[model samples]
Target: MAKPQVRYVCQSCGSIQSKWMGQCPDCQGWNTLEQEASQAATPFANKHNLRGGGRRIELASLSSEIEPAPRRPTGMTEFDRVLGGGLVPGCAVLIGGDPGIGKSTILLQAAARIADNGGSVVYISGEEAVDQVRLRADRLGVAQSPVQLGAGTAVRDILTTLESQPAPTLLVIDSIQTLYSDQLEAAPGTVSQVRAASHELIRYAKTSGASLVLVGHVTKDGQIAGPRVLEHMVDTVLYFEGERSHAFRILRAVKNRFGGTDEIGVFEMQEKGLAEVTNPSALFLTDRDRPVAGSVVFAGVEGTRPVLVEMQALVVRVPSGATPRRAVVGWDSSRLSMVLAVLEARCGLAFSGHEVYLNVAGGLRIGEPAADMAVAAALVSALLDRPMPNDLVAYGEIALSGEIRPVSQSAARLKEAAKLGFTRAFVPPRGNSGREIATVEFPTLAALVDHLTDGL
Candidate 1:
């Protein structure tokens, strides 16, 4: 008999501890620990389980001669771009997002694309029936009935279907949280059930050469739901993030084993479905109808894509003892503070008693240093009561010493800006080769201050 077990496990990381704690040490998450049935008597407790073999292996005998298989395209340009052109056969992908955030729409569209390309796709959804899915497809304008499954659909049925199909197949599980196995007595979405289900699915994907796309749920804090092990077991992880009140959604890659993880796919949510924003810079810059003070254009790079966005800042005198409020939207607050302090120390801006607020015009979050120049310009515009020229753009990083630092791909940034009708640009002196945009090179913050105030 099992020695009647007891222990609390962290739901996030699966770390087991002897006693319950408010915060998990492994994942540093509060209230994530939960009691689980003891594993002492389970088959997993024995190291000899699963193949009934000894665990010892000789490392010297292992061969590194495995050849990698070719990748297949998912059929969506934006989605394909994020996955480094296409999906690798046998690669497991996890996509997480809030409910009704278009996770199912994107995957369905991908399936249709694959089918159009003469590939087979199996889409399993536990949340919706086949008829409901078909209605949604018709509404999205795809209008197709390629493959479908309903709840109570067993994994054995899916495996059999794939075995009979000769074409390359892309399998999509609407959500991993809903899948369960009779082998595991635990309920679905529980730690054991999720892990066991994912393990089996991952194994099936590899052995069958089927590309698997698993949809996951995100927590209130925007992390993938279920144990963190789910993220580690997959080949790629993508998150759908955007304000629900808005109609735009951004799919960003958090982890990619076969490609760069910095890629992001922008989509516009409409009555029809999620439409790809091929030229995001243009879409983001559309609201700028006129040039205004405390507003400037910033050219930044997201992965290999060059983006031109607007930065707006406002400065006002505070009436109370509260430290001047520093509010930020679409950018990091601490980063804004760092830029503000740099401006005060290096450029000698008098902002001791002023309330400052900064924002990136779009709802997108930007982290690149290319935003530095535009941010600085906006702050100065508010300080000097002057607005940056509507047609002007800026891109560079500012050090604490007020020195302008070179940003990546300045030429590409300038080319993108020029395409958007920007005639003038401010850039770091060192990085500016003088071939792009009527360049206004600033060596230091002090020089920039002098240049802007000399004629005032």
Candidate 2:
């Protein structure tokens, strides 16, 4: 037998090295390499394995007809929405989030719902005891659900037990990081163990035709902890995101082989658990009985759904010789800087002596460039102490050349705004003109600035 070889693996990038290093060569992450062992290579192993013993796979034509995969609804609309409909047989989903961000809670709720609907469901927790899980189930009002529960961390034992029983319709592992394979010497949560355990679980899901949901731990930077390949091994990858100070949470699908990516499901954390928000726009919008300076309603789109959110800005003139600070919440600071630069250069606005602050209300983060117009509007309103119309919403991307560009789904945005009693929209040239709401076209940022200053 060949002796075991010692190797160092970078935990951040999953790159293997012969010796320990302070920084990873591939990812440049400092102090991320950890020691692991692998079987030493033998001379016969390399010489004997040349394409003779493997069975050939059958090929199929590209035009072959096939039926759509069947789906099992978990009785949660928001969850299903993020999933691109319902759970498909043998689908593997990986969800990651910060600590105390309700990843386990949502999975438990879904498992219970599936079990209650006459589907066999198994939930294995490596992070908590059976009693602790039961206590949570009781708190979430799902103690009576017929979901089978187990507590274990050894992947071999778990797989053995699962093989002995009939395949369940749904299988949920509380977290993949805690599971360790007996075949590897590395401890759990290491790169090797995570990769081995996930491979085994996903293989079982494929062979047994069970829908699998794996909970994943996230690093401080919000990337899922473990080898990056773990994400590619699964069919879907979801991130549960929200601020601890807020009740609303967003489950976003960043990668999905069976559905559209970038789709989001809105949920609210309550004493009972996570409840779906069917009308997310209502939850994100604030009271608009009166229009206030620095406040503007933004009609944005998340996936296929149209949403309206509030953008607020504050501009304060600092004393001469004092450096001005810029602060932003729930939006990119660099994008704000770009918008400010456009305002200063294209519209003759002076902001070098002012401190600027911008925020997206309701703790919801905006990533689309369509929010540039609304953010620019809010900043101008705050700078000039002018209030925007309460019944107006804005959506348009701004070019560095000061041109207002049209965004995708302009009609959807206008229709959503009209449904919410917004009577006017500030849109780009050739943008959607809805019958229910009047559209004001702004061909350039200078035109918008001029319109705002006209009433001043």
Clashes of 2: 0
Candidate 1 residues 1-456, lDDT tens each? 666578899988999998889999989999998987676755556664566676777686457786765779877788988888789988999999988889999998888888878787778887788788888889987766465444443556555656676524788988888878778778878888788888988898888888999999888888988999999999999988777766778888889998888788999998888889998888777466765778878888887788888888999988768778889999889878888898888777878789999987767778887687788888888888886677788888888777888887888988988887888888888656546468888888788778777742
* TM-score for predicted model 1 compared with the true structure: 0.81
Please, what is the whole-model Cα lDDT of each candidate in the order they appear? Answer: 0.82, 0.94
Specify the highest-TM-score model's number.
2
Instruction: Please give the distance, in angstroms, between residue 20's alpha carbon in candidate 1 and its true position after superposition.
Output: 48
TM-score result, candidate 2:
0.89
Q: Candidate 1: what lDDT?
A: 0.82
Candidate 2 lDDT, tens digit per residue, 1-456? 888789999988899999998999999999999999976667776557676567898999999999988888989999988888989999999999999999999999999999999999999999999999999999999999999999999999999999999999999998999999999999999999999999999999999999999999999999999999999999999999999999999999999888888899999999999999999888898888888999999999998889899999999999999999999999999999999999999999999999999988888889999999999999999999999999999989999999999899999999999998999999999896688899999999999999999973
**Pairs of residues at least 3 apart in sequence or in different chains that clash in candidate 1:** 293-387
